[model samples]
Target chain A: MTEKELLKQLNKLRTINAEADFKAANRQMLLAQITQGEEVKSLGYLAQLNIFMSRLFQPYAIAIMIALFFVASGAYGLTISRQAKPGDSLYLAKKLSERTKMLVAFDEKTKARLNLEFASNRVLEMNLLKQDNNQSSAKETLKNDFKNEINQAKSRLAKNQPEAKSDKTNDFKTAGSVKDNDHIDVAVPDKKVATTTNQGAGIGEVLEEAQKLFDTGAYDQAADKLNEANKLVK
Target chain B: MTAKPQTDKSSNKSDRNIFLSLKKYQDKEAFMQAYDLYFDQIFRFIFFKIGNREDAQDLASATFLRCWGYVQEGKLKSEQEYKSLRSFLYKIARNLTIDYYRQARPQASLEEAEEIAADFNPGLIEAETSIEVEFITAKLKELKSEYRNILVLKYVNDLTISEIAPILGKTKGNVRVTLYRALEALKNLTRDHDGEGITKTIK
Candidate 1:
């Protein structure tokens, strides 16, 4: 073949491209690297954290993490303990799990809600003991534990009410000071007063009704009241 | 003598602008543009060097990554290193293929080249069922690396001698000479195999 023909033949190799899929994937990867590097350069720690969180929350990464957590935390034990009765072997585990949940609840309202939940659970155990014809002493002890939980829950919910009002009052005071100093419209707290007053009254009444039902030994009614209190708090 | 391919001046200017933006401002969009400009040619160059699709893909990726690294570092010895991103990428790809051979396996001798020629299939190019193309590619594998590279760069990638010179670390005159000789060698290879009907088909 002449060199012209040879050249023409060689030119056919142009059709031999990198696979389109590979080209696109590599482009995405390289561009991602470029952007990630620039982000780190410009945004520093926050960019690094963003990248870390994004990778951490990728589907496969999240799945692996959830699997690792379930394995390490012995979630099967927790699951079985959720069904344990007051005198069962896993009862302590159940209590420990409940305590752990409360400890990590991150806010007082959530903790109060947990207290109400555990109190309702204690009443259920007491009722179960009565159905099983357990000793009166055991039922009495469970009833006392239920009363303590309900009292703690009521006090917690009640404490949140005044704190909410006080916080609104402080916010209004700060807004007044800011308005006086800067002549700005610092009226943010004016919006919170009505909402807080309505919510505080609603939660206070629910907690009071729950307490009255408990005192009357209306356990089922108290459970329903506790739920209403929980909803109000939420 | 084989005439050099015409260089598109506007495209070259565009590539230079993108490279500068990446270097000066660390612009990601510019880097992506650079990637678009060079990925196919770089991938083809590395594919010619390594004779396999997968390793060629990896080395091609590495070539672009290393180029980005240099842009990020902003500490090259001279501005000539930044003169042509295309040449810079080719150099990186060539070095990566060399490293790949050194670390992964022995260099492909003439005998292994034959084995590669026989075993290699451009199966990924689904519509490319031409036997002549396959035969030419196999013959391309049989040539020395320098001759093969010069021919592929000159003819296949349509790079000008001046553009190829920096990539191969050779003078423009040297690239011209090598490209001529490479074309002659390919002609002889095809001529010798005329019984296989390449000559008949061309005629």
Candidate 2:
């Protein structure tokens, strides 16, 4: 016979399939055996969970998950640190977090604004310490730190004055938005208000003048006005 | 003429995924699907090997049970072994068939008759079987076990050489050469029996 005819005849043997009744019966028996075997040696939920965890989270994956948890909790703690006083444990973290925020600011104006807000916060912290009867030395140190932060804010604003002057419409827009600092209302009025009429100016009015000076590119003068507003809080 | 089986990439991928589900999760559904898919082919394969229907049926069932036992014990090693479920099942059936022979005849050493069983039990060929089938099966029995197995896997099971290689633990080139030789041997056997009207009956 030719190979083709032989191959055709060989292919015909494929018809020797398993009988239907035998297949169905054997399948049922096999499944029952498997089910019994599974039950006999079944791992409990905890063991299965362990296996699942082991498969899903390799060493690197577990490490990544732990790192993400710390980051998330740290963020939550830092938010609470916003209220931290100078003597509190989270106080340093609060300062470092603020510094990080300032460094990440996209523009000099935003950085200067953040520094000014930080300077106000330091003065606010000092007042709270005084009320709590904290040491005089701590207040003096806070006063020095506040002065340094105000100076940095002034320098940053002065550095960006040329850009501010070029964008006249944006400068006016900045002056108009000065009232957005409604949240910065903790600054105490200066006791010298009875002696100097200008001292009678509210912190809001002093900030408004600062914004006007900024619009005119007199950034150092604007910074002096904000510094005056901060000193009055003490 | 070459008996080449078509390779379906998608189907192979799906089968591998099902096997993985069985391996990792011990998924009964996946195992059932595998059993349904290969039960007939495995039965036919065992039937060809042992030449007995009742024994073939029992061994085929045992094959799946043994496979599940391996899965439960995580005995199947390496990624390549898991790639083709059909090849893996055939490999198991082939080994079991050898063991069946070794047990059936303790007098003849398994090493001596590992490929060819001493007695093929031609009477056990299915009742109501056609003359062509009986003739081919009897002729196939005369050939050595290697030739018979290669022919059955290639033609009866429609497995490609690539699929057959891993099951037989032979190289693709070796399987191809053996397959050629097997077909030649079968053709020679038919030509020698031409006068007996066997070739005429087949035609």
Candidate 3:
């Protein structure tokens, strides 16, 4: 206890002991006696602990983060890799068909000379039913050589385009309207059978109905109908 | 102040006078410097307690002679150890006087000693004014062998409870409690003389 706290006890005994010489010294001496070296102990422990922690986890933690960064970056890169976009497939198909790299090499006004484009490959009979029958042998040859096969391939491709496209109608609808004449090329070449069968009452009929709604000042309803028209057209 | 001289003499404390600063007297040149400092304290304390000039001189001379040996041996290190050695040596001087009593007046009781102590205040001539220290030291000397050793180890030698425990072959807890009881006994003795400040004095 401090001297003040123990003062009452000291006071009571004071009168008695005063007649006699006595020392009542307290913590003053002891506190002086005990040697406390400056905070070197804590400093030592902290230095050791810091070194220990870094040594324990440094390698594994760095490795894990590097691995995670690589994994996420790989996934993100995979997600964004380029794919064929709208009308692109059709464009590709058309270009592929035209390059003489394809089967057909004829121009519209062809008086067939040796088609130097196809001349390297030999064929005996270049036959055809002539257009204006009296034209000539060379003309007939160009006409016959590629006309049948090219038309057949084109028709087959046109049919395949619609079927292939039908499955992706939702994707096409979300991506926005096919642009200008490209729209016709993308849709019409593919949907010949559907258009011939539906007459005008398929996608076109829905668009007409939506247009009527728009004219009547029901724009919201008109937009809804337009979306349905998009679905049908796709 | 005639008392029996202690027969057995195999301790470091017995070799120096309590009031002497052994550190000051530690050099060959300083031998007389130490002799001058402590000679009177040993003489008066021994003479007054034993009530005889001859034996007191003998004990006093013996105290200084042993101090001289300790100094010559170069065992006096610091002020603290020197102080400890001095106080420890005083206990030796006191025990020597007690042994003198044992041999010369074997029939005398300790009560006779206390009666002597009642008139035995050292007045202004002694080293310390604190009667509580003197009283406690006297009582500690009278305590049972183990308890007395622990008491002296605690207060006089200023050893830690941990340090004392091993010395006594007791657990630290046992040492602590024993030291406490010994202290309480000292406290009671102090209260009889001076009621307050005993606790503070020891500390």
Candidate 4:
């Protein structure tokens, strides 16, 4: 038969009368399942059977799978929770736990020299204070104080620099140069380093603060806190 | 229907079967009424699709599975809203056949291609018998699955492109392209096998 002729015949046969048997089967099954008010297991029962079979044949495998699942899920859940929770601020803590490694790739020795040079004025002011207490004007006193702090900060920065490479657990002193005064953006080591440095203490603390900020709807503040946390171990 | 504004004669036949199915499913009398109305036309349609008594038996069995679902369940309302129950179930049968192929896999070989091309005679098959079905079914087997499927769904099953798109998981445009391509391929394969003369007589 040609395609056209065959198609004509097929169309003629497309809507045959319904058979008695099919109606009985469909009606019985649908009624049986729907009245139960629960799932009709007959459809997907075969799939569930396979899962059970694996458990019986591989007891140890199942046990290990369960244990691993718990451990992995617990760890993932904790990590997600930490990500979800806003951390307590570095500003709030006042004492930052920054690793020293970030001091590397320093702009050049010139940056350090300039830093020290700028810091000297404060040192000179403190020295003058001992010679003639009131003789140093307020501006001079302020400069002197600032200079001493700058020098002290520089020295602290330099000594910590060597250890920063070998050990990533050094304190906030590594975040040298008062980064916009009072508030310092400390660099935390990578999670690898942070785990070694002070992972137990800091992660819990930082996570808690950031979580608090997030909960309060202070998204900007929460972000700032997280960045500071990242910097602490950078 | 209060006033079926459908002016198309095709829609009238289409509309009537739909109405019958709805009435039959709605009430037992309606069920018997619809069966009497469409039984001959629908049987002929299915017998043509499978092209053999036994498989047509199976296809017809499946067709009623849908029809019964329509009746007792009240899922489909009045047939006039639709083209007709026959069109609706034919759509189902086409899908069911494709799904049967996917499920059956290696079991469902393209049977027509095995026949010899030489001494091929479209005229040899008797005009009103299973002989013609075997020949055409053989030629049908020669077409690619996509073309064969569309040809079956559109021409063999008498479905609109609109009705077939959702069932085949395709756009209407895609269905048209596939249908035309399938027809062309079937035509070419027929020409190659039976000569261009065969294509003219069969079509």
Candidate 5:
């Protein structure tokens, strides 16, 4: 083509719409890089202080300063830890930070999702802890924590839809079947057994029975039934 | 077309002012304004050169990042330290493009260019124009890198010889001559193609 006509055709080629997803991702990546770099630049003295104190206090002080530095960075460290995986030293910090975030979250839907995410993270943490040969008591404590979080999530969901309470009953039945197949004699407290037999069946039924037990001044049995219901629902 | 000269002069003046503001004060607002102003042009320039969206986005970002890096390093402390932000950015893009070609898998850029041409939908352009555009794009890849680059800067980017000289580190006279030679080479490369309309225009 003549240069003029060639230029005209070249202009047409420019109109091909760039893929939107790539554009958005690239923009975010670049903006994050730029902002992060600017943050570090603006906090140059803190970084210098970190180096200075680390030198003064020797090795242990470095860890202290690093913690202080993370706090000083104002949610940046928390943001970074959101992607932390198992075996990362920051993994527990990530979980704790997420819990703190959930506490401040105003929306019920968001809080529920965050609780579910925390529960998933706990499951991942449990697997990692097991791989590391952590004490059985520690593993049990994490299992309890996961179950509690899942119950909280379910409660929030049920608040949104009362019909979800029936879904919880089906979930509990599945849990009961799995426990039966394992044949592990899970130590049910005496109070829990009394309430479970009286409660009929399912998590919703047990919770309702526990409330009735609480009204009769049988607090121990009520607490036990609540705990049992939590495990069953999950 | 009659108002084009006045518009070009005003744009050139604006670029000069932005460059000065950035150089003298390291003004971030000014830098961002420049970025918003030139991002599309810079992206298109790289996209035209590389013929791939991902690489173009990367190299374009790299170009601006490098400029920001210079600012952080206080390299742009004076106007004399650099010519114009536009030229500086284009220079970075050109160098990065060359680096990409050096490290890139052999013939990958050409293959990508061909893929782009082949994938061109006729709805985007007149059917006849689409074929002509494809033919030119294919021929563009066959040209020597320097010739291909000059043609793109002049025709595709519509940069004047004077504006392009600093970016390419060539004299304006040299840019004009090189552009003419590049156009002639492109014409000769496409001579064998069944582009009667273009052949007549080129003749």
Candidate 6:
């Protein structure tokens, strides 16, 4: 047969539309499964009996339940809080978790990193607030918080001078890192900022500039410089 | 011949919007809409490829479930990525079918294909058409797997060359060439089955 004739004969097969009863049933079942929320209700009578027996152990059971609750809530909160912004309800939860992480962190390096991350989040929150223009007072508070967090991070980095030195050369090797630091430094100007804005410069320069600005009562400018420094350190 | 269902363009767009909503917000209503939109088309595609009703249904359901997992993972974030959902579903179905074949070699028989075709269009297949279908199916089994896949995707499932490319991970030009060669091979294989050959009477 000619190729054209063969193509026409093949096209005839398109008419066959097989019906599978299970297809619809399976789809319904799957959709039902996807839409269904976890049965957070009870595990029924056995679970209730177990809980009642555990409650007889009083303090131990209470401690275990509290631990489980916090762990579960922390996991759920972390997952949902990723999308939260400054004024979001979950934003506070995100911040609380960050604080918890810092408290639990063993090394000064990790603490410094977490502080810088928190300060960065505060900058993002300020940016969002600036865009919304909803709460000048809240923006001011976040700006101050951003400054405080950066100062704390700067202190932490200062305490770990040797590790910070190694990190400066090793961690900030990429052009992207240098570019990011330069971008932040250029956005906010202060003598203290100038001290820390240099590539491979430690947190000492940042703290000095921030302290000078704070002493002069230029709080807003101090906050801006610290925010810029926070971005560099991160 | 039974008339093919007309694809509604607006509904397709709405289905896409629903998919995006499901991906971004985990909206159950949107997911249900998406499930309703593509379920049958995916099942038909799998059924044709696997040539078994039960496995096809299971694989098709698994395909959607896997897609839902991707949506939750935020892998399909953009509209461009979501627009490739059909090809993505087909790819999953294709992989699952391959796995099924690996577990049980030569699982899809001509008789199974005939049975499925008969199940779909019970009254439409007369003795002559049934014999013709059997001959075509028998010859299809003889072709290389790639050739058979292209033929079934093009003819049975009515996927365009463009749509078939991503599922097979080939360029559009490659799909076109493979499809042409596949038709040629099928024709050659079926040549002796009829005195006039399968394609002679066609215009």
Q: Candidates 3 and 6: which is better by DockQ?
A: 6
Give the range of the ten consecutive residues with the poorest summed lDDT in model 6 chain B: B115-124
Error of 4 at A204 (Å): 65
Candidate 1 structure quality by residue, lDDT tens digits, B144-182: 778888888878887767678887778889988888888
Task: Give the alpha carbon lDDT tens digit for every residue of B88-160 in model 2.
Answer: 8898888777766655454656565565453576678866687788888989998888888898988888777
TM-score of chain A of each: 0.51, 0.42, 0.18, 0.18, 0.36, 0.42
Candidate 6 i-RMS: 18.7
Per-candidate RMSD vs. true structure?
26.8, 31.7, 48.3, 30.5, 20.3, 23.0
lDDT on C-alpha atoms for all candidate structures:
0.66, 0.66, 0.38, 0.42, 0.57, 0.57
TM-score of each: 0.49, 0.51, 0.24, 0.34, 0.46, 0.43
Each candidate's number of clashing pairs is: 0, 0, 12, 40, 0, 1
- For residue A17, what is the lDDT in candidate 2? 80
lDDT of 4 by residue, A122-208 (tens): 233333343454544643544443435334434434444555445553333344434436544555334555555463345336535
List residue ranges in candidate 6 displaced over 4 A.
A2-5, A15-20, A37-234, B1-19, B77-83, B102-129, B192-203
Clashing pairs in 1: none
- Runs of candidate 3 with Cα error greater than 4 angstroms are A1-234, B1-26, B32-58, B69-84, B91-95, B102-179, B189-203
lDDT over C-alpha atoms for residue A93 of model 6: 44
Between candidates 1 and 5, name the one with more favorable TM-score: 1
**What is the C-alpha lDDT profile of model 5 across A36-101, one tens digit per residue?**
434433324664454345334333334434533533453354344445555554455454345434
Writing each residue's lDDT as its tens digit, candidate 6 over B15-41 gives 554555555466444454455556766
Q: What TM-score results for chain B when candidate 5 is compared with the true chain B?
A: 0.72
The superposed Cα distance between candidate 3 and the true structure at residue A186, in angstroms, equals 99
- DockQ-based class of model 2: incorrect
Query: If both were scored by TM-score, which would come out higher, candidate 1 or candidate 6?
Result: 1
lDDT of 3 at B10: 23
DockQ per candidate, 2 decimals? 0.17, 0.16, 0.00, 0.06, 0.07, 0.11
Error of 1 at A126 (Å): 42
Query: How do the candidates rank by DockQ, highest first?
Result: 1, 2, 6, 5, 4, 3
- lDDT score at residue A15, model 2, on the 0-100 scale: 79
